[model samples]
Target: MHIEEKQIAINKVAALLKNSGKFVLSIDKNKDGFIDTGTRKITVFPDTPAEMKSYIENSGLLLIEQFETEFAHIFIAEKG
Candidate 1:
């Protein structure tokens, strides 16, 4: 998708999550993708949108909890 399309899609997803009081957790499946952890291959929960990893921080939901797996990040958010 183009940049605009991608932004729109992200916005839509953020709206849905925010409306439902849900937050999205982006996972660094590669592990090395995140700098905080090095070669550990463990799941990490990140609060900041550092390293240009994800824009879910802009989802407009409050981070309540987080979970991690080999494939994805699991996040729970509370409505503000």
Candidate 2:
């Protein structure tokens, strides 16, 4: 996904967690337009969700769907 879409996804995941203690954020590139299916480097900004960011940092998880560059993807999940 592009920058705009990535941000939207992150926000949606954060909102989803507001009602639940845990949540997972994923995208199907085959339909989402990201043809590069694999782990794309996801950077954490100061504004990134605290819980989700923490999980990523702690686990150093690779949240990318792997395949071809045409199908870009990333997967992030958190439980606490």
Model 1 off-target regions past 4 Å?
Answer: 1-7, 17-20, 23-54
- Please give, for residues 1-80, the per-residue lDDT of candidate 2 as tens digits: 23444445555555556432444443333333343336674433322334334444454333332222343334445433
Model 1 is weakest, by summed lDDT over 10 consecutive residues, at 44-53
> What TM-score does structure 1 among the candidates reach?
0.37
lDDT per residue (tens digit) for residues 1-80 in model 1: 11223335555666665445654445444443234446554433333334222344464545667676776556565556
C-alpha lDDT of all candidate models, in order:
0.48, 0.41
Q: Would you list the clashing residue pairs of candidate 1?
A: none
Model 2 weakest lDDT span, ten residues long: 60-69
